[model samples]
Target: MCSRYVGFILLVWFPGALHAQSAARHCPAPALVGGYFVPVKETYSHDFQLTYACENTYKPAVEGWWATSVCQDGTWSHTPQCIDEKGCFPPTIANGKYTHASDGWYEEESVIRITCDKGYEHKNNLATAKCANGTWSSLPTCEQSIKTCSMPPKVPHAVIVHQGYLELFPEDSKVHYECKDGYRMEGSDKNPIVCLAGTWTEYPTCSKVTVRGDHTSTERGTQPGSGGGGGSRPDSGHVSVEVGTGRGHSTSSGPGTQPGSGGYPSTSDTRPIMIPIKDCGTWPLVPNGVVVVQDRMFLKFTCNAFYTQVGPEDVVCYNDGSWSQIPICKDAFCVMVPGYYTYGLRLSENQFIKEGELTYIPCEWNDYSVAVRCTDRRITHTSCCRSYDHQWKRCSIVRENFLPVGSLIKK
Candidate 1:
């Protein structure tokens, strides 16, 4: 009976103990020992799901499936592997191009240099762009260059000088401005506008000329109804005598003929005078010491009293009513004296002597003295004997050899 009882208890207890041990056997989680894993933790439980995402510029190694796995029993369903992402397409640019290419695919933070085409200018000389996460950064633009200027802006009462057949003004090209007739520039005469960096510089303006003194026109011929005997002579009598030409007269005699003195008509002749009106109008202001001589159709200017004439002196009045260029008078001054003199040479209160003025050199240093007069804008020296000295040797001095000496004569 004891043996039967002990055998029954051992049988029942041993089966129960084995059943409880088998129920306690559970899985911890899936282990990703082969490759990288998501939801990296020290421990995991059963039926745990993990979704995988690759790093920047990297993607799943496999194709056509979600990068995911789940823990079941004691192992994972799939292991995740990553590979480099595909590079961006070659960049396209307008008026520019990219350079410095590599053979392999571009990764994150990859840089590419850019360059503009010829004749095109950019803000930066060399430009660059970067790639990140399969996308490129913003690129710089390239446009047509602008280094020349068109016909410059016009100024009031001024004209721009067109240099031959040039249609456009290049950089640094100079453009000159000239004032028109009856007007003059207020600023400097040489003021000009220059092209700089595809733009024209500021241009100056022109101002009207203001005349000085009284304005009056001189009369040339006699009026029609003047009762004086100084009436205008006949066309053939005075016109030919003044102009030396007979091609401009039309003569017609009336039924009553009255002969005048000096072979001229005492009364008015009905014939029309066909004198070609050649008048240069009112004369411009003349300089000091200037003389104006006027003929029938011409005027001549001359300077007097140590003044020289500059520019055209003779002006002819054209039949179309225009005059030639006027002239100016310039003062004539003496050149500087070459030597330093202690005495004997004296000048008046005026430092500069005009032409045709007289200067004297005293006889304190020599028995002979000099009298100089300016002629033709030059000094003419003539030696005159102060007094004859027979005991002392007489010496003559030339104007060209005028210099200071320690002793005029050695005795």
Candidate 2:
């Protein structure tokens, strides 16, 4: 009976001792690159966990800046590492792909070219992107390209000059128009309507012409006859005649006879006639302009600062109840051409300069600049020279003299 009890106790004690030995087993401190671990020790027992953090510009290989690992059975559950944070992942773009196939990470300042799929183009016409310090610059987006414009709107009393059977017009295409008979174009005949992107510019208008002599007036008169029945034949005397102007006619009537015996010619007689005159209402509105003179039969218009009058400045109202001609105000700003530079400053393309304003254009010589003025949509004074004294030499001179730099070009 004593031997059996000793064997049972030995079996339970052996199992407990094995468990303690296993628990005492330890793992060496893990080595991390570009990082350090917290609560560091020479060795760690089983189930012991340690936290690690990476240095600046470096990230843990696991997930975040900090990570954890455990010592299990004399071995670490995970090996910690820190990698460069200045690298970028592959960019995912819709309706676009990289010009060159690349699957690896992109380093800082690396450029990548992108190509949009068919029927699409890069936004703002940009086709490349650069990785800047772990983050990519603004990437170009794929958008549907506008290549053509639909049929242009029709203008009253005007027809397209040379339009063919085609329905769509390519971008930047221009179409001319001609006014029909009895009508005149209100805008400039040289400037044609243009197609821009997917739309057409404003079409020109044709105004009708009012013909003269459409209204008329008439008057009646009578000459004396040889008969003498003065007092009694006052109502029936003389030959009456009628005359008219503008679409009127003439008429005549025979003389009257006396009551007793032979008839006698009557005295002259005259009758007054009245006619209504045609009147034109208020003056027509002028865009970008104002009416300087407004009268019952006359009107005058003046354009704004940057606009020009396209027609006559004054108009007259005729007897047909219509004005002679209505004027329009057109844009008169100067457009900056390519390679336009002035006074050490480079002007942007298509820059608008208002009328009556001055612009200094750079000359062939670095020290010289040409003074040009915008007048009625035209650039005046295109000559340039190194000095005002040498203005006549080495430059295409104009009739008008150039203004001094101090007068126009401000510092």
Candidate 3:
């Protein structure tokens, strides 16, 4: 069935018809034995030629199959047949995959789109390949796109873990930034800078760490240097600070030697203050139908399928390091009304109600019908009474379930 063996074939049995003309007067084009013919005509004159084409993913079995068939003296000179062309197999790529094509075949000049999996990136912009004459041309590969950050900048009185190495950093790399024995990060020791897009993020500053006998860190803004006992406070005159740029040197700024005065500590330079949930030593836990985004430092709520979100979508982190008001997820459908038989009850799944939808429920023993609608985040019920005379009257139900507006209902 391969198309490579395409050549002419001769038959010795039809020797007389090689030069003989047909007995019929009109030489309509004969039907092809195999494959299909193009430019179909209602009537064919003598010596008319018609072209034939094969189906998709197929080629002519013989070179003459691509040539025109002649209708001479009401007969075809030869019948054309088609065969399958050699196709390219699935390509092998690293860190990437090829998209599936229809019929699972790669024809000549077929372009295959390539995509890298998560945590990987395409090298250079060559994300595609073409099949040419049963061979793939210049197949591209996906390389590890992780970029490690260089060593962190030097900060006095602080101990950085996994420091300095040109090839150590990768995308989303995290490094521990803790202060030494008598020092702590400006705000907290757990705060670490992440590497993103081949660059290291901003790191926290180191300040003098004050520890009480109970092992709890003292609040920022407290002056350092203790006096009489382990629990005694430092003198108000001497301000504890770093001196001479060494890890072990400690000095105090005199009353006159404030900030801007010969490298003395400033009043603004104090211990790190605690932020709300960020200082809890762990990421905050989010409830169902919600997700936590560390980048914006907030919890975003999202409803499940067939449910509608009623509250805010974005909860942002404030400048004070505290989180803003978080929104809640709400159910989309209303609750089923009591003491009513609805039409097509068996067909419904009896799930949560959808907002802006109208449902009909008939009275169990009476002809009275009720129409319940979900709108404006609340459910409204309307009653239709079928009187003795067969007249219908619209009434309102006061004992119906009332869903409060702006209230979140978990599905």
Q: Which ten residues in a row have the lowest lDDT in candidate 1?
A: 402-411
Root-mean-square deviation of candidate 2: 23.0
Candidate that would win on TM-score: 3
Q: Per-residue lDDT tens digits of candidate 1, residues 66-95?
A: 377666555555545454665443567777
- In order, candidate lDDTs are 0.47, 0.56, 0.49
- In the order shown, the candidates' Cα RMSDs to the true structure are 35.9, 23.0, 20.7
- Of the two candidates 1 and 2, the one with more favorable TM-score, higher being better, is 2
Enumerate clash totals for all models, in the order shown: 0, 5, 8
TM-score for predicted model 3 compared with the true structure: 0.26
lDDT of 2 at 54: 93
List candidate 3 segments past 4 Å from native: 1-85, 146-195, 204-411
Ranking by TM-score: 3, 2, 1
Which wins on lDDT, candidate 1 or candidate 3? Answer: 3
Residue-wise C-alpha lDDT for candidate 3, range 281-371, written one tens digit per residue: 2222223233433442444555433345665765554222334556644445555533343332222322234577664443433334445
Please report how far candidate 1 places residue 376 from its true position, in Å: 7.1
